[model samples]
Target: MTVIDNTHQRLLPAPAADVGRLLDRIGRPGDPLWPSPTWQPMRLDRPLSVGATGGHGPVRYHVSDYRPGRLVEFTFDPRIGLTGTHTFEVIDHGDDACVLRHRLVATPSAHMRPLWPALIGPCHDTVLEHLLDNAEHAVTGTVTDPVRYPWQARLDVRLFSVQVNATSVPQNALLLEAALPPAAGPRSDLADAYAARVPPGVTTDPQAWADAIFGNPPPAVTALFRLRNALVTPFGIERGDRSAFDTISRTDRELLLGTDAGHLDFRASILVEPDDDGVTVTLSTHAVAHHRTGRLYLALVRLFHPPVVRAMLRRAAAAAVRPRPVTPPGLPTTTPLR
Candidate 1:
């Protein structure tokens, strides 16, 4: 067994109590401050308390201790090669300042020790820095120098040929894959949520859904897309057509949307199917580059594609599960009798 220990700390211009509040809110799923694009918003099954279990994705732990406004500690449950304690501690630095420290002490089995230095360590360091930066921003109302994913951290992202093929193949390919909670109702609920946000005439058909959301994009996404195109325009890449979603494709369980920009042809599809656990939503894209410049543009798109799709799907899932308000009886309906 090899012991692996790491610590990271940040000084914030805020009271200890304030810093503690910010720390307590860490590890939420979909939190913007979490640096890692894949694992986000670590969620606990219950409120913070001793004996409660929580962690993100596959990393599960039991809360061993907690002191309000000061400390929280979690003990790992023998995962792979890791077993030990992780802690967050807050120290007071007078009334106007405080320091927050995160410590991890683990014993890694022989096979895992080598992985620690080469892969885990670098990624952990990047995440810690971002966490501290978020803490400072929450408490101080400013982030001096925001941490960005270094090349090493980006390289740490796990990539599998299977995942790529699963998402990028098939006509009107589904590029993003996700599973929603069984209680979220059904795929149609998610489709409705997405459909509600798209422009008029965009339907839930898989192909059209994909085109409206990806090819044409909404205003918010279009802005970002335009900016990216502007940066690469000098290199011969053309801007996307904002009117692409005006066309429609309808199918039983699949929808396809396609567009041509410069020397590349873009096709996207959405397929929703029910499964034993819940519904599976797939958003996929297939691009054909006719020349070198189009290939270059496609490469950049592929780099950012997964994270963007994940984010969009996550948001959709959240929206799908959100409880809707029920109007009480006797209230006037928004419709009049004919």
Candidate 2:
């Protein structure tokens, strides 16, 4: 029966009343305090009333208490093995400064104890500190001392972050369907799409994402491409070069790139479209096999394609918004920035 009582507080430069005004808008769109999209934004069904129900990420909770501007407390859903409440409090400090504090008081279910200190704890700390950073940024227009995520926490973030999922190639992904129009009906050799969440300020334009994704690719992805390119030399083929992929088409919300070789023809689309909360960035691919070897190669590569594409998109999104790239501890310096 282990208990947990964790607290994080930040001294804001504004008066309690002023900070409270910011607190009141916690779950609203463009929420200034929850450090959203990067982390799941706190959401409530309606405004901040006692009984409003919602939770950020996988954790579930509902408002148990609220004081217009002074405080807000949420009691966690017990089925998740956590019992108790977490809160955000605004403390008056006589003059032009106030303390903003977040405290979590809970007892984990027996099975949850083991995972808390390792996986959950680091992530919790990371989220709260960033929340506080957001608060400071809201009050002062900038965060002077932002939290620096440790490599392990970075891994945890990449592990638990919003998932990328297979989705319909959106209508806006104009190039996905346009690239191989001849193969559209039944002969389409390969077509796939995946979407990832993007936060408020990250680059939504495909060109910026292209730079981040292609310019500084994940280490494993870069290595995979290197091997892929090397396999083509003996065939006297022009190796696929990510940096050299031509911009085949463009729209306000989409960018298309592709290349051709003796055996393979390829095209990909990056679509940045707005969603209610932030943005949905989709990566859609289209390809045609020009030879039996090309068909075999694409079939083999399909087994590993989704995960690789997800990693690249997530890395690009992170580079667009994170203060600094966090590489896993043992990764080599020769690898891309993320």
Top TM-score prediction, candidate number: 2
Candidate 1 lDDT (Cα, 0 to 1): 0.56
Off by over 4 Å in 1: 28-33, 36-38, 158-281, 284-338
lDDT of 2 by residue, 1-338 (tens): 67999999888778999889888988777677776656656778998899999887689999999998899999999988799999999998669888899999999998789888877887888888888877776776665556778666677556555457789889877666677666454755678888877556456678776667667889999899899888867865567765356787888888888887777778888898875466778888877888787787788779888888888877877655454422233322221100
Candidate 1 residue lDDT tens string, 81-176:
679988989999888877788899999878778887987778777767767766665555555555556656655433200021233233333232
Off-target runs (Cα >4 Å) in candidate 2 are: 182-185, 198-201, 291-307, 317-338
Clashing pairs in 2: none
Query: TM-scores, in order shown?
Result: 0.53, 0.84
Top candidate (lDDT): 2
Error of 2 at 330 (Å): 28
How high is the lDDT of residue 7 in model 1?
91
lDDT of every predicted structure (CA atoms): 0.56, 0.76
